[model samples]
Target chain A: LAKTTQPISMDSYEGQEVNITCSHNNIATNDYITWYQQFPSQGPRFIIQGYKTKVTNEVASLFIPADRKSSTLSLPRVSLSDTAVYYCLVAHGAGGFKTIFGAGTRLFVKA
Target chain B: DVKVTQSSRYLVKRTGEKVFLECVQDMDHENMFWYRQDPGLGLRLIYFSYDVKMKEKGDIPEGYSVSREKKERFSLILESASTNQTSMYLCASILAGEDSNEQYFGPGTRLTVT
Candidate 1:
């Protein structure tokens, strides 16, 4: 299992882009970088995932360098509703059962 | 959309009480998981099931058990609840063999033991 490290918290103004990066120095070859977002008192929802290069979705974008040791989750034009805890994880396909979620980056989008 | 539903949003129990947290998914997913979330621990997996009657222990499985009697329902059991066990419990499910590692999650159950 690959351990992930992320910033404890971050602050961003509304309409601004927010980028949170995670470090996983021991990522395996079969590991994929995945991100999830959680609101207060709610379960987390998948944001974006990527193996390498860049992957974009409706909610967020995931960027992985060639080394795959670190990944960044980019939120474009963040809103107040984007205030939540974002988790970064490394796991194989459908093998999220073994994934470990460390203390995620708590993003506070202020208006 | 895949919907995962838990039996309760909030639950209160005594220290020695037996607790059962039920989770059901509308999608017929083969993999179901139980996790507990804490202030600083993030989300810790407790147990998971790949198919009915087949289960595996996760990172934190002490004082917890699970049952998967059907394809869409998974249950977490606490034989003897403790105050230390008070936390938000989350349930998730995903289809086996899918290329994506996306797991649909339930709203979560806040369990408090006195």
Candidate 2:
């Protein structure tokens, strides 16, 4: 399992773009970068995932550098409902992969 | 949509009491996971099962055990509950092989051990 580091908290305003970066210096080659968002008491929901470069979905975008050392999650036009903790994890596919989620970046969207 | 449901949303137990946390997924996924979340510490894996009757210990498995008798259900057992074991318990499931990009999580059960 690869370890990830992210900001403890972030402040953002409604309609602003929010980007949270996660560092995984020891990331593995076969690993993929995945992001999840968790509301107050709800379980984390899958946001976006990417192996390299950029991957975009209806909710967010994931950007990974060529070195695979770090990645960023970009949320466009944030709203108060988007206030939650975001987690980034590096994991492989299949066969009981034990994923370790670090202390996620808490995003507080203000009106 | 893949649905993961836990047995309870909240629970209270006394010390030395036996506790059981149940998780069920409707997606026919081959992998299920149990994790405990606490303040400061992020989600820590307790155990996981890739197939029926097969189990694997995760990062924090001490004082905890798991049982997977069927493919859709996974159970986490606490033989003797302790106060320190009080925390939010979560259940997750994912598909097998490369398509397992993300793990779907349950609503979680906040277990209080007194």
Candidate 3:
């Protein structure tokens, strides 16, 4: 399992774009980067995932560098409701028991 | 939509009492996992089951055990609950052989042992 390191917290204003970066120096070839969002007292929700390059979805975008050592999760036009803890996980494509979630980045969306 | 349901949203138990946490998923995912989340420890895996009657210990499995009697249901058992076992327990399931490692999580159960 590739361990992920992220900032403890980040602050952004409403309508501003937020980017959270994760560092995984020991990422493997088969490892994929996945991001999840969790609100207070709720389970983490899947946001976006990518192996390499850029992958965009309606919710967020995942950008992976060529080295695969780091990835960025970009949230566009953040709102107050988007304030949550964001987790970046690096695991194999078929990750089952090998999945690990570290202390996530707490994003505070200010009005 | 993938839906995972836990037996309880909150539970209170006394020390030395037996505790059971049940999780059920409607997607029939083959892999079910039990994890405990704390203030600073994030999420630590206790046990995971890949198939019926098959189980594997994760990072933290000392005070926990799991049973998967059916494909959709997995149960976590704490033989004798202690005060330290008080934490939020989360259950998740993922389909096997899927290209994406998307996991569906249930509303966590906040267990308080006094």
Evaluated with DockQ, which candidate comes out highest?
Answer: 1
Computed on C-alpha atoms, the DockQ of candidate 1 is 0.77
How large is the interface RMSD of each prediction? 1.2, 1.7, 1.2
Q: What is the TM-score of chain B in candidate 2?
A: 0.97
Sort all candidates by lDDT, best to worst: 1, 3, 2
Q: Which portions of model 2 show Cα errors greater than 4 Å?
A: A94-96
What is the lDDT, from 0 to 100, of the residue B78 in candidate 1?
A: 100
lDDT score for residue B75 of model 1 = 100
DockQ for model 3 equals 0.75
lDDT of 2 at A6: 96
Candidate number with greatest lDDT: 1
Query: Residue A9 of candidate 3: its Cα lDDT?
Result: 96
List the pairs of residues colliding in candidate 3: none
**TM-score to native of every candidate shown:** 0.98, 0.98, 0.98
> What's the lDDT for residue A35 in model 1?
93
In candidate 3 chain B, where is summed lDDT lowest over 10 consecutive residues? B39-48
